[model samples]
Structures are given as structure tokens and as C-alpha cells.
Target: MWPRMDGIRVLELGTPGELRTELTELTLSGAKTATAGLPALDYDAEREAVEHVGERLVLVDDSGMRAGEVEVTRVELVPFGEVGWEFARAEGEGYTSVGHWRESHRRYWEGQGCEVGDDTTIVCLWFRLV
Candidate 1:
């Protein structure tokens, strides 16, 4: 009943490829309880949705299918260079250290046409699979 595998789906959180696949898998496996995004997205309306706790999001795969779902449990704004290790660990990206997270995020942000710096504000979201 979650994916439906047919019609009217949920908000697609990730892009159309590897990142999406990895994130959805992580969510399904319950390893990933958190995610982060820039508040400067053009289509996200200043990323205000995270302000509401308990909001549900359906994870969509690159093939435009529902992969999983999650609910927002906590939200915080942290500097790109200041994201704590606890949060990084929760991302389930196998980051050995905060420095690794920063570099990986920096690469991802660059791919999105954004230049990441030490002071960049990142929306950190903690969620629960449901």
C-alpha cells in the first residue's frame, strides 16, 4: 500500500540516479534516519516544510516510483562546516568523520550549482521510517 506501484505518489526527495537509489535504500533499511539539503533551492519555497514536525515524505526512486516513506522528527539549521558528527552518522552515508561529510556534501552542492563554504547554512532533518 505504501508505494502503490501505479499512481498518485509522494514528493521525490532525491535526484534521478545514484543518490536517489542510495537514499531510498538507506531509508528502507532504517540505516538512514536523517538528511540534509540547502535552503536555497529554487522550487522549495525557502525550504519551509521542515518547520513542521511529523510531516511525511515519500521517497521516490529514479524510475519515478515510491521507494519508502519517512516522517520528520527534528529539524535544525547548521553551518556546512559545523554539522556535528552525530548528525553525520545518522545520515548513513558511512562517513568516517565530519570532514568526509563536508567534502561529500560540498561535491553534491557543487553539482547543484552551489558553492559550499564553511558558513553555508544546511537544513538538517532527522526522520523516522514509517
Candidate 2:
């Protein structure tokens, strides 16, 4: 199970290293207001509920320390191929295009041992720092 702070779920971005640090910084700087997750692996597999609108979460740093707070503004189950440019850009990863985001995500998910395809469901979660 994942850790919780004061009963609020902890939001950890990427992994506990450079990726997490970069993502955390982006969120704190207001450059990132959204993120993507694999529902099957992140929610179902972990027995955690999907983030909903108005849900508050504690943002954690690479060391699992609370860095800030965020409130979910939207949640959508979008097909991998159906992800739009707006959401991709909101990720604040500086992707030049949707194709770039798709390819990068494909490689990341595949590296995590998941067989990703166009039909895979992606949890498009939007949040605002609080």
C-alpha cells in the first residue's frame, strides 16, 4: 500500500530519483498541472481509488517527504492514442509534439514492463497546487 499523510493520499511522481525531483519541481513551480497514470497498474493493482474532481492529495518529493498539496480538478480515462495535445502540454515535460509525448511514454511504460498499445487506457489526471 502507498503511504498517506494526515489521511490524504500521497502523490509521488515518476520514481524516487532524478525523475521524481524534476517532476516535483515542475509541480511546485506551477509548470505542471497534470499527470498520467496507468489505471491497471496504479489503481486497480494497488487497490487504490482513482483520483476524482476536488480530491486533495499530498505531493511528495523523491525522498517521500511532503513538498506541497494539490487538488484534483479533473480525471479522464483516455485511450493512449486519443490523448490530446492540450493535456500533453499541461504535463510540462516540454514535448515538442504529441508524437514525442506518445513515444516517450511508450518507452517509459514499456520499460516498466507493461505492454502498451494504442488501446491502452491512460488515467489523465489534472490537478492544481494548493
Candidate 3:
């Protein structure tokens, strides 16, 4: 979720189809100006605003876990844009390579009764590091 300079929160739910429908519906109820899909996000506008604030941004992922669930994993914030692209390309090659990672992971987890929906949600909550 990328929050614009004007406090517009943009949540990117990386699912197969309209996984963000739930979030978008909630936002429309009162959030206002809420939208789904990355196309609606004006990256240029965000880039310019980020420059004024800072280059670094924090992304929070709270999709799979239930509300108020204890977070056992550590949250790591990665800088986006060129630097982020380079980092992902170098360190996280698997992330860049499109394969059956999700399916494989789902299968592995499903064996243990953990089921990830047909679409995996990659929530990106963009925020300043302060």
C-alpha cells in the first residue's frame, strides 16, 4: 500500500484477479479516491513526492495472516525504484523469475493444512521511515 503525499493510501494486493476487491470496497465505503490495480497509481507523482520526503519507503505485508494475529516473521523494508530493482534482481532473483513458486509454496504449505487461495496477495503498504 503506497500512501501518497496527500495521505491517499494505495494498497496493492498482488492476487491472480481482483483480490483487492475487499480492500477497495472497504475504502469506497468512506476512504474515498480508493482504487484497485497498479495502473491507477501515478508512479511519477509518487516519485516526486517521495523525493521531497525521502528516498526510502517501508512496505508492510499483512495479507495472509488474520487480523491481530501474532507476527512471527521479521519485517524488512526495501528501497524501491532503480535501487530496489537492482537489489531484487541481484539478491532476490527468484522473485524476478516468474515460475511456479507460488504454486509450489502453496502445495508445500497445503500439506500442513495451510491453504493459500488461488491468488496470492502481495500487500505493499508504502510509508515513510521517518
Candidate 4:
């Protein structure tokens, strides 16, 4: 049986539909190991909660089902425009360039009612499948 997430804080790793399933499969298959997000909340508190290296983060699917865990290896807080291409590629979102990541993330943040700006901060979480 899959280990229950229970009281552990979970983050949604997949989008809706087939893409969601695909990302989850990649995680389980050990191909995709990193993720990035722009949380619309208190930055300091949120960072304190999630940015610890060696900490375990519970990854969930669109249905909120626990797929597995990842151990945080690195974390970076950088402006939207400052996200490096190397990290963007690590996202495994099929984004061919930093520009692609910027466009996609802008749409996602805007869709969530959050305004995206060049100086807006994003938390980039680098992890390994655990």
C-alpha cells in the first residue's frame, strides 16, 4: 500500500488530467525530481516551513493522493525574471527555455488571482525522490 500522508503537509505536484498523471509517473519512475512554485502567502513563514534542506516533502497528485516523498536538496528564492534556465529545465515541465517558464508561470499565477511581476519572488525547491 502507498504510505499515507496523513498529517504531513502535501504539495500538489501534478496539474489536472493527463499531465497530472504524467508528472506523478515521472516522480514514481525517478525522472522528475525538482519543482518550483509561487505561493501566494507570507514569504518568510512559508519559506521557513518548506525551504529546509534534507526535509521531506510529501508530493500529491491532482486528487490529493500521496504519491511519494522527496528530500529537499536545495532551495532558492529569486525574482521571476531572475530564474536561471538550468533550474527552469529542472522543472521538467517541457519548457524549452526560461522564457517559456516565465510565460507559463505568469499565466498560472494570474489565473490564481495573483499578480506576476518581474520582481515577484518564487520559491524554487530542488529535491530528490525519497
Best by lDDT: 2
Global CA lDDT of candidate 3, please?
Answer: 0.29
Cα RMSD to native, each candidate? 4.2, 0.7, 13.9, 4.1
What value of lDDT does candidate 1 attain over all alpha carbons? 0.76
Model 1 CA lDDT for position 96: 98
14-113 in candidate 4: lDDT tens per residue? 4577867888887778767677777564244355354578877688876776778888899888898999898888777678889998998888768766
TM-score of each: 0.83, 0.98, 0.21, 0.80
- Please provide, for model 1 over 56-127, each residue's C-alpha lDDT reduced to its tens digit, 9 standing for 90 to 100: 776677787667767789988888888999999999989999999888988887987888888988889898
List of clashing residue pairs for candidate 2? none
The residue ranges of model 4 lying beyond 4 angstroms of the native Cα positions read: 1-7, 14-19, 41-48
lDDT of 2: 0.93
Q: By lDDT, highest first, what's the ranking?
A: 2, 1, 4, 3
Instruction: Indicate whether candidate 1 or candidate 2 has the larger lDDT.
Output: 2
- After superposition, the stretches of candidate 3 with alpha carbons farther than 4 Å from their true spots are 4-54, 64-88, 95-130
Cα-based lDDT for every prediction: 0.76, 0.93, 0.29, 0.74
Clashing pairs in 1: none
| lDDT by residue (tens digit), candidate 3, 1-130 | 3443234333333332353444333323433121111211323325532221223322223343211111112122222211233222222214443234344434544563445553433212222122
Determine the backbone clash count of candidate 3.
Answer: 3
